[model samples]
Target chain A: MAKKKKAFDKLQWIAAYKSFVLEKGELPATVRELAEMAGQTFPDFKKQFTDLRQLETAVIALYFKEANDLLMADEKFEEYSNKEKQLAFLYVMIEKAGADEVFLQEFQRLKKTDRGFAVRLMRFLNRQELSWAELSWGASTAERVGVNPKQAALIQHALSTLMFFLKDYSEEKQDTDAYIEKTTDVLYRLTDTSTVRSMVDLGKFLFSRRKTTFSWE
Target chain B: MGQDKIAVSKYQRAGKLVNTGAKVGANYMKHYAKKLTGSKATKQDLEEENAKDDYSAFSELKGGPLKVAQMLSMGDQVLPKAYVDQFALAQNQVTPLSLPLVRKTFRKYFEKDPLQLFDEFSTEAVNAASIGQVHKGRKGKQEFAIKIQYPGVADSLQSDLRLIAPIATRFLGLKKKEVAPYFEEVERKLMEETDYRKELQNANEIISGCGNLEGIHFPEFDPQLSTDRIITMTWLKGLSLNDWLATDPSQEDRNRIGQLLWDFYQHQFHLLRVIHADPHPGNFIITPENELGVIDFGCIKHIPSDFYASYEKLMRSGQEQDSPELIDALFALELLHDGDSEKDQATIMGVFGSMFQLVGQPFYSETFDFSNDSFFEKIYSTGMALSKDSSYRNLSARGSRHFIYFNRTYFGLYQLLHQLKANIHTGQWTFIAA
Candidate 1:
């Protein structure tokens, strides 16, 4: 009779996967190898993940989830403005990523070999970020006319920041921190309705003046 | 309203200073154009325009260049009133670090969030320091003032000074070689100011040295809680000197506060040899008990024995205009260089002689009335006359690097006293001639 199949939790598989990538300096060639490294059966690994790619996506998503969980745990998180929430999330995510250098290294390496996987991971992350942004902005404001553009800009910002973080070599990655602060500040300023409102006011004045000039002509 | 975010990148900061240079060049072009058109644009008008442009840029940069501007403004004798007026504004307009950034800095230094370390930490900065912002924090019954340095300030300082050097030389009307030492001096002090650990050590040294001095107070620093980028000290409860002056304190009160200020500086200069060289009003506080509070020890200048000897001689001989001893001391201090021609020497001696005599008047007296408008008028006119004098303009910069901060210290002290309108005894220090 075959040995009884032991059930392994998803987190245990993730923990095993992260250490394998860190130690071997590459992802396991097959799920069987990862399960064997973790002293578990291949069926147990298959129970948690469909493939190594799915496992990779889950590992990346775990960073986001952990970052979000940390932010949500903060009592002040609820009181934060939308901009502050976004900033807090970025800072916390970078911090989380910083703590897991092996995972980031592997993620960067995977991006070079598997562009499709990188895209999928980014879309997954973006969806998570967008939902958070919507929650912060409230459904009503999130559905407003200009917010979609702002959300699009924010997603692009998040992507660029991730790219920047991968290349950041400053002491304590302070350059990345400063970049996030400055760009987010600019984005919020650009999307601010007051500026749009003023432009509208100017347009009205210009149109009224043009009409009067036409009448005079 | 949100605080203006600081220009953070090296390129961004460098661009701002470069923009000032371009603006100054544009101003000059405009001045000449106005002249070609026979417009009534005097040199003063061009200078005022240049100064305004420079100030706006420095205020925006708000790190090294802004500091240099403040130091230049304090040496009111070297700059025009227009530049002085504009650059003096650099003292107040600093953009604070965001709350998240502040927490990030705290975490970097302390390995924990500010809120985690303190029982109650302020999310908003209570005040802005030159290179950092001050936040109030509390732990149980203990209240603390925490100073958090802006990110990349230290790293960018060297580049900022490099960019400012040429502009500074032009603005001061001196050769690059002539201004190098002063910039070097300012650069060193500014670098030291960015290191909070050094500042904590400086504060401790000053407090221990001047701790026995009457009517003055210092905050107890917490070294365990302090780091290179953040300083945690017991919170000082007081009004800033300017605010204290606003409450319309009596003449006696002003004199008392002024005496304490005078004694505090004199004690540092005479006995300790290391002085809190930054004497700006913001660095000082008048406690609710009306005692003097010295809050910042960031820019402490340690006077070398040789320099202090010459300085002492200069002060003692300053009252004697045209005296050989005074000229000898001036040469010793490098205020009169060996390369100077007789004409240049005479020009420098003539201007600096009368200037020092007036500046040294307080030391000459048992008690000097700082409120005497004529006294400040003489100083201002001497400065104005020196700036306008063509012969003086031709002379190269001829002062020791030490003089940059040394002159700043005295001039700032004089300005503070003048603002206080206090009459205080100045001949009490041990170094003064009997």
Candidate 2:
């Protein structure tokens, strides 16, 4: 991927936020919202980008943060990581826009305000949700320990989810301990053979345990 | 009296004798009454027609648990011999695996034909089980046994079960609030049985659990060949328990082999909460070394946390009989019928108490000599007689959802033991101490 350009200074970044509000017809999202859309504070997120646009460049990133919070609370994601969190967020976004007519309507109403917001939001929406892109996650045997490309990819997907789900994940606090422990387990299992193999039941075991089922219509 | 009244008919007497509550008998009457009264269709005549219908439906469902129907058919033998003869025409005519149906299922699941994936596949099935059939073939250098479940079997499960059940809520009854949990359990276990994936998990878990133990063995799964409808595993060697017993093995050999099954189950309960819930003698094969090769991992019941607590309590009781604890255990299992009368509860408990005594029999002594048919006959006769009691009916519906397979499995194991005439070390081989 080419390095994304068009960096914004703090004020220009503030102006972009203004433009976003002017177009979106909502109050300028709070700094807490700005610093926390990806569930990361601005300082902690700087490794990915130095400028404020890194946070505000994408309007759907804010929406991703809001929905990702809900997905995090779900039982399935009890022990997800940052990469996994992002992919899950992406999946939610795609499934929501593709399948939910009402959500698409609300999104369209906001898009009518400006083409720029519309284009960016549309691109982010479901770019890969229903696609067989994450087939690895869809139908895979247990994760192999250490660094097979498959394991690395799966772990990256998990880590991205954590980075995008739990705000202040790096903060050393008692309350944050739950999130920490969960991510640790998911990460550890990504590298643990017995847990992965046993749970997956390897290549053949997956089929015998499954009932003949048609996908949801 | 001026004139003798017309003699009462024999059919009239039978109508008075049979229970109106038994819908099956009433249904039999209603069907036969038409043909019997009509010159063209007597009761015997109607049975012949019904037999034809049952045969077609059985073939249609692709073997829809017709064995349950077959068992009920045996009970129907008490009817007049002519009626029994007509009913005997019903044959479990299962069709062999057709290449087209096999291809369609493969394409539907994998987006490709089975022939493309599986080379040198067998169209003929070597054996049939409750849910489906198994075909022996080769995927490559590795030999495989591909299992194909009949089509549309899942849709017919509820109707098939309702048709087989002695009493539905319509004949007997259950609480309105209680229906959801009760049927939810039956549907769940049956669904589990339908899922070949769950079976694969069970196969692996069992392989992991007791694979290394001497005189105890099971098959390892090869996953690429498996799907939701089909299970592929490495071909296993040896004859099943029924085959071995038919050969008339010596008492020493029978006892040693029986000990392996007992020990294997014991190891599962203490080491893993999973219980192998299938009891068909064919599932257990005897090898040359006398090692028991257990196949067919289709029905497995994993003991949930709550049930384990009850099990712990039941195991703790020394007298080998504790009514309150057992009821508590049943409660954990969701077995207690919510609106059962005291008489009903006691009768059900009495049945359970007898079985507890039987299972615990081995715990008291060094070994269990199952060659004695009388001991098993007592248990069987007791269960069958208990089953006939009107109030004890619908008890299965009231029982815990998860425990259905587990409970059925114990009866199956005892029956298997009796048939094998195997003597097993019950006290040393199980969780009786715990």
Number of the top candidate by DockQ?
1
**Cα displacement (Å) at residue B290, model 1:** 2.4
lDDT of 2 by residue, B7-77 (tens): 11223212322322244355467776766676454556555555554443443333233534332233221
Query: What TM-score do all the candidates reach, one by one?
Result: 0.86, 0.52
Q: What is the TM-score of chain B alone in each candidate?
A: 0.90, 0.72
DockQ of each: 0.38, 0.01
Find the 10 residues in a row with the least total lDDT in model 2 chain B: B1-10
Best by TM-score: 1
lDDT of 1 at B113: 87
C-alpha lDDT values of all predictions: 0.80, 0.54
